[model samples]
Target: MNARFTRFALVAGTVAVTTLGPSVQAQALPACASNAICLWRFQDGTGELYTWRGGYVDLPSRFTDHVGSFRANRTGAFVDWASGKECHSVRKGDYASNYSGRFGSKIDAVGDNC
Candidate 1:
């Protein structure tokens, strides 16, 4: 019984280390969060996405490592450059600003912090 308990603890510890230690996708973008305002962020490395109805937030999305296929709402969105369509999504990274104020089809990468 003692051996079993020890082994169980070891496995649990290993799982925790692997799960949160490293970034899953070398190019899988990062994680995102909803700010007080509640908006989604999506950019190359870390940016926000503006919705039509909902204002700004720390939404969770990722940037397509490919450099194209990024389209969400309108703001911060641009032609795929390669695909000609807009489609970008990325999670929080390094750092990000706050989400508040007017929230509609258009968004600014950096805005006044809340």
Candidate 2:
């Protein structure tokens, strides 16, 4: 009976590990607080992080033209470039794992609307 219990415990432990493995390994995106936008310096949400809640915010010197990915957790926002001449909109729950090519190291500011 003791041997049988040991076998059952081992099987249960293996099952729990198997069930939880994938989720633990899938956390690639950095944490962004609710009602904010998070920008990463590299693709797949890796590297330096910048977070904004609202209003017109100019990117800091380091992040200005170096934003490589973004996750917008708010209602909406606009990304500006060339001193606001060019803009891109991102809605709530929108995210880009890699946008370096599309925006091309030209993101200047972030705010509501274009």
Candidate 3:
């Protein structure tokens, strides 16, 4: 009976450790779609996500001035069209991890030229 109890306790401990271990493990951020650019409301790819395919396009109302971080999966650029802010380049494979001040919540459009 003692040996059986010990084996059960070991198995229970292993299961608990395995279950809790992943909770603290770092999770992979969502990948930006191929041939597209992505923006996030917070840094490190957290919060809301917005994706834009190839083309000249204006950001939607919610994302007009709410982009805080970005991942340029393809070649493109983002600009603040509202206040005529300068264009911010987003080269292919570029990841702006934190846009807290520079380009933060000010992007209004995505296009080939600003």
Candidate 4:
């Protein structure tokens, strides 16, 4: 693995299985084609200091309304449209829920805290 990929892996574990939505239309979008990367890092909101590496899905699932699980590191976590939160608080090696809707739905996107 290269440096970037290595770092990504350290924060976000290897993607075990990605589900392409039953609807073929959803697969045509970005992050669904290939080389989709999820990045995560700690932030001060104003500057950069205490940072944590996190993987970003950009576009996690190929299917809308689909719930998929991606591998995460010990300190890594996930937050999808389903979790109802915007931040990634998903726990690695455990079951995490997320909303695979269009752009993290506003109505039903409920992310759970870890």
Candidate 5:
């Protein structure tokens, strides 16, 4: 009986650890203000952050080719590449945890529209 109980407890502990592991490492999107565009250097809204709420504006030197994630909160906007070409459009409340795969690291500007 003692050996049986020990085995059951060990199996249950293993199951609980495995089930809770993923939740402990889950990532969440960072907070972005309304009517604004937020940029992050790393995926999942982590790392350096830059927020813009005005009209057409070019990204600073540091952010030109480093944007990895973004969130358009209550506003639509256009993301431009370093070659002055529109990369894509982000609608209101839209966000991307990792855009490096599709967009690459050529982001150079951002504005209300393309």
Candidate 6:
């Protein structure tokens, strides 16, 4: 019985170590250029990456409902809704690990606020 308890403790300890370690912490966002905004198709900065520079622009059809993560390398990157409202703004050096459900797959445009 003691041996079984010890084995259980060991297993629990191993799981705690593996699941709560730094490796399981949030990852650094994927790279975006100095003056660009990058959106990813998966959270934690994984999957397809789409980059944008300056200008008022519509997200290409391929990415309209696909953006999941984002990093803003420029000072005033704005995520626009189809209703022509700015739903969220990402300042320079900022990152969003995930978007809200209402805006997540609904971002229709992107542009510089400055």
Poorest 10 consecutive residues by lDDT, candidate 5: 74-83
Quote each prediction's TM-score: 0.23, 0.68, 0.67, 0.24, 0.70, 0.68
Stretches of model 2 off by over 4 angstroms after superposition: 1-27
Best by TM-score: 5
Off by over 4 Å in 5: 1-26, 81-84
Instruction: Enumerate residue pairs that collide in model 2.
Output: none
The Cα RMSD in angstroms, rounded to one decimal, for candidate 1 relative to the true structure is 12.9
Backbone clashes in model 6, listed as residue pairs: none
Q: How much lDDT does candidate 1 score?
A: 0.35
- The lDDT for every candidate, in the order shown, is 0.35, 0.80, 0.80, 0.31, 0.77, 0.76
Superposition TM-score, candidate 2 onto the true structure: 0.68
Backbone clashes in model 2? 0
In the range 1-114, model 6's lDDT, one tens digit per residue, is 999999999999999989887764577786888888888877778887888888878887777867888888885545656666755666888887875354657787787762
- For model 5, how does the per-residue alpha-carbon lDDT over 1-114 read when each residue is reduced to its tens digit? 999999999999999989877663436678898788898988889888999886778888787778878888856455665565765667787888886665627677777776
In order, how many clashes per candidate?
24, 0, 0, 21, 0, 0
lDDT of 2 by residue, 28-78 (tens): 577689989999888889888999888898888888878888888885555
lDDT of 5: 0.77
Could you give the C-alpha RMSD of every candidate to the true structure, in order shown? Answer: 12.9, 6.5, 6.2, 19.9, 3.1, 4.4
Candidate 4: Cα lDDT at 39:
22
Which ranking of candidates, highest TM-score first?
5, 2, 6, 3, 4, 1
Most accurate candidate by lDDT: 2
Worst 10 residues of 1 by lDDT: 63-72
lDDT tens string, model 3, 80-110? 8665567977788888767756776677788
Candidate 4 lDDT, 1-114, residue by residue in tens:
599988887656434223433443322111111222122111111111112243433332332233332223334433445555445453433222232332223222222333
What TM-score should be assigned to candidate 4?
0.24
Summarize candidate 1's per-residue lDDT along 2-90 as a digit string, tens digits.
99999999999999998889784434433333331223443333344332223333322342221221222222322233344333333
